[model samples]
Target: MTGNTDVVVIGGGYAGVMAANRLTQRDDVTVTLINPRPTFVERIRLQQLVGGSDDAVVDYPDVLGEAVRLVVDSVIGIDAAGRSVTLATGATVGYDYLIYAVGSGSADPGVPGAAEFAYPIASLEEAQRLRPVVDAAPTTALVTVVGAGPTGIETAAELAEKGRTVTLVCGEVLGPYLHLKGRRSVAKRLAKLGVTVLEGPDAQVTAVTRDAVQLSGGRELRSTVTIWTAGFGVPDLAARSGLSTDALGRLLTDETLTSVDDMRITAAGDSAAPSDLPFRMSCQAATRIGAHAADTVLARIAVEQPRPINLGFFGQCISLGRRAGIFQFASKDDTANRFYLGGRPGAKLKEFVCKHTLKHLADEARKPGSLTWVKDDERRESLRAKRGEAPATAERAA
Candidate 1:
């Protein structure tokens, strides 16, 4: 054992768990993972949890490899130069390398009263608290969902199906990422499920309150419950650590997923910005980035050359209600290239993808760094060769 040569992973989300388990595969390194919660929260399925799904969470022990050490504590900050992290409990842990996978949270809409009155379905705890309030409200209670993105759409559809008068308010078109056909299909399903979608120019929400939501044009929507899922903002942990981060609080990393300031610290999932490629804030990217981050760390520890990230997001799968959804097919880069399936068939495919994502994690946890795909040195070399010498740009020209 490489005594004290431990990899410390921050956060217990998908990316963090995958990296820890992958690092544990090497006998030369010890993996210590720090997280605030004992169990890993399936953030993608938080909407399902709000819809009363009990299978949205997995116990950490059941999903983490035995070789990985789990510490339940919140990371307060990181001392990147000193190779240590300070915890909320006033304790410090040293590490040879670090992986930052502290995921994102719901973006607070800048509208007045929104923060105080709106409930966001971003975390498990938040969703759990929302369930009871929703379940107890009158069957005809009005529930307005701000933002017509996947999260907002799913929450509105689920609540509408539960007999609530749900309205989805969006400043732009519904499913802005979806093609016209897919968007129409989603709208159809929402209407059929008794969901009212207020989109287009007048869809802007100006304020939220306990009784109703006010739109930009002074239109008042009487609502008993208000949900805000307009956007997401990753925590400023990277900025806090004095690392290079984007305006959105995402750590700026190279294609190799290593922080620009220090290669010893890496980032993945929603918290990582891979140089220039647009990394979508979704589970598909999270899973692939997690695997790649692990590969990057393992390569460094095993003294093998690191692998380049080659992620291909097949599509976007969102559950509209209990039995309907829209599957917007896309290229490896997630640019909605086409639309393959929608409605029930699309919903089934979405379910399959979610199951496969968790199963991949489960398999990795059981084997502890046994993914054979990481050893493809040829692919890594080819990617590096393609990313050949950076041409003289205006910035470099100076």
Candidate 2:
């Protein structure tokens, strides 16, 4: 345990960068970040990218620590017993520890014709592909954004602001995570932007064609372009590598973020299911989980017992357009409260959050182990009780 510890982190999203940067805190530890892209994609800004406002990318030198080695490759398989990873380059990389941070992607819509017709903005490539498509379409083209989550709402608002006829089809409820007051604010803003908001069971999309979408109540809406953002699914790398995973393909881990199947392996971000209870897939959760995952690996390398995770939520910020947004406040457990900031102020706050996310990674790169977060004691206790474990000591750290 005294010589050196080599940790290979898969995926180069917010979580992967944070973990790699934080691991540099120890001089004895070497961190290698494996990713498919050389630059970091600000996933939260993909809507702006499609709207022709921003490019939604950052250089690796701006966010990743100088000490962290960057490997531009994809991990095809994980060899748990041999403690190595098989990369797409047909090379094997040995590691003392592995951090599974492969993020989530657009879920299969499952509806007929959806796979062939609908465009998704879940990743950078998808957003890039859709940008040109939107630019070439006529301004009056009928655009339909399926799903009512943050991604769907933001995409609808962005396109509507650009003078495209947009229809938001809420599968169940618009902003299902939003409180009543927050939802109302979004509804009003979307209405002002000339976006048609469709809610209720009848609004659910049953199927999609090349130029139209069919609703559940035997209704068909003419759509020149359809954008699907209903659900998210994680990569199957963990399952394919013979690691234990939840039903959704997220790596199963304990409260300490260590994989339940192998102590040498840990997980973070959207692809991690800690105690079978994964946090909501968002940048707000990803960065914190990434920091925690690094700390777990560092503790293990030092021959010290790692502490359990103690994460809390602040709120959800949804951008309506360039000029308006909604910052829905939440409790420690991430349940929306009645209070919110809407309109121009909310828009400014949302902009600040986006900038701060990038600033966070840059700061962590300069000052290793600088990021910190709040802890939800109640949620932690509930999870421990469900596992029939003893009460954990109240110890909180970055």
C-alpha lDDT of all candidate models, in order: 0.81, 0.94
Off by over 4 Å in 2: 384-398
Which candidate achieves the best lDDT against the true structure?
A: 2
Candidate 2 scores a C-alpha RMSD against the true structure in Å of: 3.2
Q: Per-residue error at 182 for model 1, in Å?
A: 1.1
Clashes of 2: 0
Reference-based TM-score of each model = 0.91, 0.97
Model 1, CA-based lDDT = 0.81
Compare the candidates by TM-score and give the number of the best one: 2
How well is each residue in 1-398 modelled by candidate 2, as lDDT tens digits?
98988999999999999999999999989899999998999999999999999999999999999999999999999999999999999999999999999999988888999989999999999999999999999998999999899999999999999999999999778999999999999999999999999999889888999999999988999999899989999999999999999999999999999999999999999999999999999999999999999999999998899998999999999999999999999999998999999999999999999999989999999998999998898876778788887777643421
